[model samples]
Target: MSIERAFVTQPVPFADALGVLRAAAEESRLRILALLSEGELSVSDLTDILGQSQPRISRHLKLLVEAGLIERHREGAWAFFRLCEGRAGLVDPLIAGLDRQAPPLSEDQARREAVRAQRADAAQSFFARLAPKWDQLRSLHVPETAVEAAVLDVLGPRPVHSLIDLGTGTGRMLALLAPRAGRATGLDSSHAMLSVARANLERLGLARVDLRQGDIHAPPFGRGSFDLVVVHQVLHYLDDPARALREAARLVAPGGRLLVVDFAPHELEFLRESQAHRRLGFAAEQVAGWLADAGLGAVETRDLAPTAQAEHQLTVTLWLAAEALVAAGAERAVA
Candidate 1:
């Protein structure tokens, strides 16, 4: 006798559901909700916590309110938003899904968080003194136009698909090279620096660029993920410049280029302490050796701007190197 077969049902289409769910799935939005779940938050609190523009954060909150996921109340000139208790029917499921898909906080993430907290404190202190006289303070250093031109000359016009800018202070290098790349990620130890970088990029209306906070000696991304990597004016700040260079090399894809721009050897002890710089400067041969140790070839070192006077002189140099890719036939033979 033939038995009747039981029917099995297909799973729900997560792609379609996620599309609708993602309306509030943004990183900033999620963080806002999570924070608000604890208590009410004004726009300024969100700006400080998420390090986002007031307009951008407000837009996300509005979307959440429209979606019936959050409730907002206006008192005088300030507006506060919070997660509605029973009214948040859809938000519960979204939060549950987000919790499941959230990236784990590893040791590196913890370290970065500590660094960010410290940097935020330091930046607040620095800005408290310098914010009012920002123009004057900025003018004390080299002109931004000169720095931009020097960066462009160092990057050249080569096509770069995936790039990383280590210690990407204000993301100047990433902004310059992002147009020539398929994707770009900036890594920095200071959350304040990354915040400035994010704001700068957003002001330019740029997308597909990621900014992460982490140390240069121990970055968070995987090995060999970038087609081109840059460390601009950052080597002098690292405790171990050689180790940081090796870490940068680990992120370079096969045949990818690595460009380092910084000052030549010098004696700048005062700046080293006050600015938290670990080294004064690096030599060309010393940098080349680090690149070779990291499995890179075709190393080229050149000076960009040299000082005219003997006493009043500041020389800049650029070190370029590429990872040597192995042929498929050679790999097969060796295997």
Candidate 2:
């Protein structure tokens, strides 16, 4: 292979490279690699797509995992597999060499689309059922366009290296900000919501972004993992918004930022009962205090109030905070 076309990672030893090629040499394993090149899929998904037995597909996956050609992550009882990013230098060229429009590969692509289409249909039905309730709440606030514009303005025009959306409902923020992010991930406690997000992202061809079933208060990522962290329209549902902010802030890298979007203080009692809201809208000072306690500095706030024509609507607030670079330095110094 030409040097320019090779994978851009630490050079692999000849022996290890041979092992990867050996594991991927088989016909079925080659097809699996091609399928996963599109997105992550479960064992069941592979069986359905390839029209193969579960045990047969599982065995191939095991070899691929051991060979470091693929990686697997478990969610509940099910596990999903994808091409190992670390192995991209080796695997990418192999998949790229495949003639996708050829017989077996083309057939595999058709079956894969069918599987994803089924998932999309199911997720759409679930969202359709809840759409009315969401629409009702949306009407009670300033338009989403206004809030999104304010959010964009607050974050500025620079693209971030990495971003995580805490409680990413339907993956809206992930999709919106994805163009500006080199890597993006969304975490939510609800598996159903994640399913919806997965389908939505797939339709948008954003298969590169990762989605996981995880809690916002205790996210699975390591400290200082992302350049930007966002908590949008989620704090009102939590009993301890401050604790959640602290956890989200922990993931912000040095010199990174955290952006929060939610409703300002309001006397909306019905929201508590009907919407399962744990708290009414938050006050500006209340959120700033939480951000400060979380070791975030240079806090900036913006409020988007309902227009005069919509007097009864709720006001949406945006809070952008910078990671305390001085605090991070001092801690490292002490350590």
Candidate 3:
């Protein structure tokens, strides 16, 4: 592969490259970087895979992070690390050049899988406890088949460069839209939910998709970063739905679109009480107004109501909005 295609990082100063070289020169640190390129990992996980003391593994991680080769974020009680995006090009080729089948990497990879299996089991247990309730409530809503079809119709056949799903419960939306996006990310507040998403994606072998734990009101991604943003079955759960809508709008790049899926006004009082739903449902006008105020043009709205045979079923509404693409050209002219 060409060097340009190997890593997606921007060029850096000479000192920066020297610093990266120095940081990766060590044995343990090199192994740590190589493993991180595969996926994010925690200190405990690294320790387990390396068969070394926690302190030793952490030291190597600290050095790599200090050199701007990796990034760390706290998820509940655990700290997880991944290669830093800004400097990934520097480390990506280095890690790629390693002999995967030789030395400790082969053995370390086996242990890493074992550690991840244990993690998946714990996360599945949490989901297992909630599965019964989920299944019962799922039947009350419109079938996903109709909703998914509507979403794809609105998006068309062209591939989007980047896609993001807010409140990406179990990563269902990500899986549905993966084929439409060049790279996709699913965000959720619960680590347990993220694990469920990870497992779902892993089963499908969707290496292009990523799952991150983050807030709906304050997502970690940059503004105008995603060409397609989805808010699926999430607004009814938020106390400030307008604020969340604005946040979702902020992520849509120029010429991009946002799709929101939720109940179209219901009298489900029990859902509010039992399911922690803040709003029973939303009116089409209310949602359109929210999208308008967030600087998005109202493209189209569709409703998928149940058939006469299912009076108890809830109707699901979809709203599509687009950000004007003029800014992209203007920015290019200025450059």
Candidate 4:
């Protein structure tokens, strides 16, 4: 689509169109937009790739954000910028028109790859340092492939409109289910973990998946904002698993569902000391009661235990619960 056709079909207000054109009219800002079209990037990433000062890059980002040509997400001390969904018609066409192989655009692509390579290397180092502990835990479960397949089976063939994965480590769950959802988001408290997730998702061309660095205890979203909510292998690390479940339940829209994947009750005390697990595991009734307290109903639990030969290992449990649609409807009616 051409830039003119984008504005003509979308029919943005005249002032808005002018602002967008002004934002992209600049040479440096245009390059930034091209780089962002590939994936989300921080100001530092753009600065390094464009070889411009931090202040200059930030100024350009601010202008694009204000013009609605891009959007910014602040995660702790760092902020990431990406193409704005509302203005994609305008931005995508403009980026598509770029002569990618010519002049400064070619140089920018090379630098972008170098920056991404460094990011991947740093994320790999972090994972490498913890791989032994992670590997030990994995060995105690049914193979992850089996657990993932079970999760899919539990979800069935229903299409998800919007999904959020709490404590999204490595973004594996988001990648697994995103293709079946209209939009996907992943949240983790650890910035390092989010970086690892970002690299993994981007490599798989799932760059549009929103990755936010946030606490599971207090997710940064309004109640009932998502059609589906997932809490995978995260409850064990929390001091209060029930509280996290309540929070996860709060995000489920009316008629939507929550999926919890974790280990069943176990005597894995060593996990507390070695892996910093706050809780060993949870029982079926224990989690069901929590979901009920959160106003979710129709709870179901499935267990996937290690093979008979590996009985000493932990049993992975999957819990599915639905938001109380009648209650939600009544509340809406009352309001």
Candidate 5:
């Protein structure tokens, strides 16, 4: 990513100035900008919050988009609206200067909070239905900040040409490690999860990321590419975990490293029945052998176990493997 520059808020010419002002002059349209500044919202979400008809909400959105005050993107079957960077610069300062304690806007802010609460409830229900035990196991581990810090420590400060995150749920790994690479891609199988990842990426302004829906067992990528490949907490969900590892290994460029993160060996049979996890965890030898079978050289492994104060804990293991620098031209790990 490049350096951020300040917004140059110059006045608009005579002809378009009126149009821009008119777009924000309406009661409904002004509130739209206020809500969007918080996060992207769908037409349905706006309709629900404003207690307005779909046609009326869509009409206001059309005017806002025409005025360049906001932008729209279609993901899967839903269209989401968010504030544009350049245009938002012109509007946000004025919005921030407004008396937020005013009558109608104060009430609108209350409604917005209610909408966000409802959305959070729905997201929790969705995840619980999909992987209850996995969520439970997540609580048993050491705090996530420590795990992410260890992952960063393992990945030295050297910059990379490209990186890929397999099973990139919520795009956290790509977001976490993207600064170390020139470009990064995140692949996932679920559309619902991809939508969540897309929103997070757009919110953070990480424009260099490319996302696609694909199976980890047969990733859609060129052979011997990607300076780094990551399989983070994905194997537990798959039936043929080795096949996915082999596929991930195939994408590692020569001299490149493959990082795998997952729970260490554990007696969590409940995960299989409740969370749809096919494997409880992996042994150091189990994953090391997989890397060897996939033609990657074993490097090192680290186990970050919880402290004595923490009961019902799961030890997280991280394994780093590499493709020999001389073997980039070799055929051992090619797709």
Candidate 6:
């Protein structure tokens, strides 16, 4: 008589909950929450810390507030947001779950973070001085048309699904390859250069491009991530060009290619001191050796004839190398 049927309720679907949670899981939103946990911060405080526009930060904060995860307090002219008490009950467990799944930051990440900080500072100073005359400064380098044509010629008729442009100064190479590739990533150590690159890409209405602050010798990208890797006019600036070449090769996917365009052997003492050139120029043989050491083969080097004569008389050379997985494996076995 006491054994009446007991009712049970089904658990909530994690997929639905995750959908809601993911909306708040964005980089800017998460950063805002983490910083607010310390104490109240004005929009300006967030702007400086996150290096984003005030409107951008405000929008993210509004999303969090609307999500019931944070509450905002107005103190005079300033508005600050704080984590909601009961919301932490939801957020804490969620974060703990994520913590367990997250991997520890690697050494490369640490080094990149440091370099990013330095570049940010340097970029601010560099651009502050150069912004007024950026057009003139850019003119000192090769023309956009010529640079674009050179890159396209080297690319040839090959189908490129993914590409990485090392030292993507002003995103010139990224722009040229963006239409052909499914994804294009640009890496450079100078934040100033990346800033210009990002602006250029944005102006061209290209959104599927990623730019990272990193050195050529030790790129931030994962190994073997790109089907086509390019290093244009960047090798001579690095202290270790050979290591940089190897890193470029490492990023090449099997059956993919690496294209390098830089100056061949030439004397430019002024560039060496003024522009921080590591070497006057690289020899084709030297480049071949580096590519060979990196397990790449079928190297082809071409010296592009200059269209006009100038004071520098720079000799532009294009080196094309391929990384075939089957051939590489055979070589490894023989060794």
Among these predicted structures, which one has the highest TM-score?
A: 2
On residues 1-335, what C-alpha lDDT tens digit does candidate 6 reach at each position?
01111123445357745644875689778766655543345576677667789999889888887777777754345564656644554565554444322423132234334544554465567667765554542344455467568768866987887889999887878877776776677888765677666556645656336666677888766878998999988888878889989999999997888999887886657777656678888899999899999988878787754457643266677898889674566578999
lDDT of each: 0.67, 0.88, 0.81, 0.87, 0.79, 0.69
Which is superior by lDDT, 2 or 5? Answer: 2
Decoy 6 TM-score against native: 0.61
Per-residue C-alpha lDDT of model 5 across residues 1-335, encoded as one tens digit per residue: 42132356777677676777778898899888887766567898899878899999999999899898888765467777877666745677767776668856777777876766665565556655657555676788987788899999998886777889999987888778876676677889876776566555654666336666778998878998798999999998999989999999999987888999998988978778766778889999999999888998745799999888887478999999888563444545673
TM-score of each: 0.59, 0.93, 0.88, 0.90, 0.62, 0.61
Best of the candidates, lDDT: 2
TM-score order, best first, reads 2, 4, 3, 5, 6, 1
Ranking 2 against 6 by TM-score, winner? 2
Clash counts for all predictions: 0, 1, 0, 0, 0, 0
Q: Give the lDDT of residue 277 in candidate 3.
A: 86
Clashing residue pairs in candidate 5 (N, C-alpha, C atoms within 3 angstroms): none
Please give, for residues 1-335, the per-residue lDDT of candidate 4 as tens digits. 10111123476788888889988999999999888888789999999999999999999998988888888888889999988778876677778988999979999999998998899898999989989999999988899899999999999998788899999998899879887787788999989999998887777778778888888999999999898999999999998889999999999998899999999988979999999999889899999999999999878799998777774489999999988885467568989
Candidates arranged by lDDT, highest first: 2, 4, 3, 5, 6, 1
Instruction: Give the Å shift of residue 304 in candidate 1.
Output: 2.7
What are the per-residue Cα lDDT tens digits for candidate 2 across 50-95? 9999999999999999999888876677788977778888889889
lDDT of 3 at 153: 86
Residue 149 shift from truth in candidate 3, angstroms: 2.9
Tens digits of lDDT, candidate 1, 242-265: 889899999988768898987777
RMSD (Cα, Å) for all candidates, in order, is 14.4, 4.3, 4.3, 4.4, 8.0, 14.7
Clashing pairs in model 3?
none
Two-way TM-score contest, 3 vs 4, winner: 4
